[model samples]
Target: MEIKAKQLDSVNASAHIKIPSQELKNEVQNLAKKASKTLKIDGFRPGHVPVAVILKRYEKQLQNDAEQNLLKNALNNALKELKKDSKELVGEPYFEKFDKKDEEIDIEFILSFKPDLKLDDYEKYIPQYSEPKATKKEMDEKRKELLKTHASLEPIKGKRALKEGDFAKFDFEGFIDGKSFEGGKANDYVLEIGSKQFIPGFEEGMIGLKIGEEKDLNLSFPKEYPAQHLAGKEVVFKVKLHEIEELKIPELNEELLKKILPNEKEPNAELLEEKIEEQIKNEKLLKLVDEELKAKFADALIENYNFDLPKGIVEQETDMQFRSAWQNFSEEEKKELSQNREKAKEKRDSFKEEAQKSVKLTFIIDGLAKLRKIDINDQELIQAIYFEAYRNGINPKEHFENYKRQGALPAVKMALIEQKLFNDIFFFSKTNKKGEK
Candidate 1:
């Protein structure tokens, strides 16, 4: 037997093992001797069968069993030589070579270990920003929006022009630099004035325009607009008003109050208002660190911390992401990629960067969770799964079994850890900043 092991990087190792043919034969004989004691061949008495006869009867099975034992022994020896515990290993160590040669069986295995993340002062990665707060005016607007949810749109009876808080349907075409742009035109688009869903100054620009009125409104997209081409660009929208309507909100009386708060103790208009305020405040708090903020925080953390990732783990993530994207690709795309190996590789490689980031964040989150002692116990995890299942009208036991079968429980746990870790960071960081308990 010969063994050689080397750490390739911080998180990966390589091992080469060799076993001579004579040694392999000796192992096979050992297994045969053990099996001979328990042999039950019709021609042989139990515990009295000859080793030669046993080998003859189960030559292939004995050899395979011996080979498996040898593989385990080889890995154990290699790990001992490397001064590493098998418990510290990441995913399975895969064989790069397991070929039988003239004199020996050669084996090469690549092992990946979890990286040691020194996450000192990691709280510096959290992005600093003011939390969103609900103003009285905004609260009133929320109350009105809630009212509109249960309201009906009624056409105006009189010849009234469009005004603030009025709903209008109109045709419009937008031009940029004297040329029309994509998504810059609409036909009979219904809009509520002061809703502020469109470009800034757009709804307000439509104010005072009457039915059958034709006008042109100049506007500019916000500087932080998602569309890069149209961001902060001046544009002209030629508009023609078609009709006007108003949201006929139901009266906030006893009947509507009961409908809004059926289970409340003595439901009333005051109770509804209080519920609306609470709902609006809760929404503002939940959305305080929105997607954009989370993304920016992730970016900052990735930039701040640098570490080497396990190559095998990254490859696994990249493969998974690529396969997920491939399933969503149109049939034509699949066919195109299938015919061109290079294009297929390029498409797969496109996910590598993102996979690397995802793996890094996973490690970072793990380290943070450890630092904060954040955890989701088995019972908590079970309760979460059950709650989610019930919310979605799924059988809790069935959902749990499905997750177990798909090997997704770890992913769920990790997500929960990440969520709790961030929540702790945000809450404590904000409270400390405010000098509050």
Candidate 2:
């Protein structure tokens, strides 16, 4: 047997393997000898079947099995010679070409692997971003929102039409072509006006409607509506007003303060204001760090590191992303894609670059974490799990158990490490700039 491996690209390789026919013949003969002892023939006792009869009856089968075993062993040997474990390979080796001649069996395979990444001065590539701060207006709005949550809803004093910010209970039946459709009828549904919870024009049409009054709203469904039958169709919504309730927000006074801070011996407005400000700042900072700054830093890192991505990983990631995006498409859009193969292929191809970037960034971050010795210890893991549970309103113990059962603890740990690494890098960059000044 002879093997030659060549690097096709940074992340891919091609291997040519040749096995001499003599070796295959020898393997087949050895296998036949081993099988003869266990042979069961109607005309002969065990271990007494003629070798010629066995060869004549199962020559092709024995040869094929021997060929398969030889190929597997050869591939394993080749991988060992390359100093790569099977786990390091992406996807299965793709057979590019194969030929069987009287003298030798020749085969070619294309193998994909994770790319080697090299980063120079990676710290300098970390993008600088200003920490977000909450404005007074935003704080005031948050305070008002808190007050509203504590507020009560009261029935309108007298006969009056519903207005924005009023809660209404109403019955609605929608018709297309004078026939009611599925999911188009509801009775006594309470909705907050101006909340935009209903379809476009449905909520706006309910405004100014008095109790016990009925109105037919002529509206057209959006072109991209999820329901295929109703998309872009004109419909009539026969709405009947039931009751109107107005919100009565409590003022930020002594009674409200005492109620909110029952544990405080003497709750004061100054302390409350300071607490609210701090909460707003923390919220703003979290959003900035999680959503904006982290993404920018990742993008900058990706831009700075140039490396070939494993083709198999990029393809799989692209398909996964495309499936997720496809779930959000309107029925008509999906049908169109189903009908046009080229259009669907184009759409899937469009996600390839973004998928490559995402996959490449994952490896880069993982390598950086290892190089920097960033790790999530058991205590940190517990704290992270509890923090996640608190954010998601779940029991920490149950969440940890679920993660463990799903074998997702490693993924969680990796995410925590990446986040900590980025935070540290950001802090170091900021402090270094300050020191330079």
Candidate 3:
């Protein structure tokens, strides 16, 4: 056997392989013998069939099988010779050409793989941003919101028109084209006036209605409404205001604090306020880290690194992105896309650059993980799966099995590794700054 590798580009290569005819002939003879043991002849016993008869009866089939096996072995050997693994391949290698001449069979294969990345120095390319802090005003607002969660609703004392922020209990029936539609009527429905839970003008029209008052709201559904039949159509809601309720927020005193935190040995107003402030600060910081810092860091990394992406990998990533984005669309939007395939194609095409970037980033991260010896063991993987299951309110065992069936466990592990890498970088920066101080 002889093997030669040629670099087609940064992310592609070609391998020319040749196998001696003598080796193939030997393999073909071995296969013929194996097949002969299963043969049933009228005049000969099984396993006693003559080699000449076997060759005469199944020569083409045996030779084809031998060729297939030889090609597979040769490709594996060629990859090993080039210091590559089949797992590193983006897709199956393309059989560009093959031929047989005299005593040797020659074959060429085109292979796609991840390109080598030259990452820029992280300390210089990644930006620095100040950690977010929660202000007193923000803390106060959060505290109020938290209090409202525990508040009780009480009926209003006097005859007054409803207003925004008031919870109204009402009965209503909606009609389009002077005919009632499905899901157009409800009895004793409780709705917040400003919640926007109902269609436009339905809640707003009830804002000035007094108890026991009935009003007809005439409104038009937005053209982009999910229900195609009702979209852009005018409808009338005959609503009767039955009762109005207002929230009575509790005072943030010792009794309320003790009720909120039953395990506290010595709960006080100061401690409660401190806890609220700390919670708000942590929430804000996390939001800043994910939405701002992470995005900026990723963009900087992309700008600093350069590599050609494997075409097959990029196409797969792009298709995945397109499907994900399409799944998130409203029914109306999906209908529009389905009706116009060109528009859908344009949408998919728009993701090409982003897909390339995403594929490149995965390669860069994998390379860094290798260099840094970042790894996730079985225990860590199980723990991560359990955590994910808990977050999604699913059974851990079921989630694990689902991931395994979809072949997504590796993707999960990669996500965990990337998260760990980012966390390490963040903490390292913080520690280095403190050391400088």
Steric overlap count per candidate: 0, 0, 0
| Sort by TM-score, top down from the best | 3, 2, 1
lDDT of 3 by residue, 5-61 (tens): 876777777889898999899999998887778888879998888887888988899
Worst 10-residue stretch by lDDT in candidate 3?
A: 428-437
Supply candidate 2's per-residue lDDT for 284: 68
Residue 52 of model 2, lDDT score: 76
RMSD of each: 11.6, 8.0, 7.6
lDDT of 2: 0.84
Cα lDDT tens digits for candidate 2, 1-437: 99887776777777799999999998888888878889898898899887778777899999998998898887787777676777879766777689999999999877778767766467665555555567889888988988898899899989988999999999999999999999999999999999988889999999889999999999999999878889999999999999999999988899899977788899988878877887886676566667776787788888878877776677777887999899999999899999999999999999998998988888888888877777789999999999989998899999999999987797688788888887666544453232211
Backbone clashes in model 1, listed as residue pairs:
none
TM-score of 2: 0.64
Give per-residue CA lDDT, model 1, range 316-407, as digits (tens).
88889999999899999999999999999999999999999999999988998898899999998999999999998899999999999999
lDDT of each: 0.86, 0.84, 0.82
List ranges where model 3 is wrong by over 4 Å.
Answer: 6-13, 18-71, 83-107, 110-126, 259-265, 303-356, 367-437
lDDT, residue 163, candidate 2: 94
**Candidate 3 local lDDT, residue 153:** 98
Cα TM-score of candidate 3: 0.66
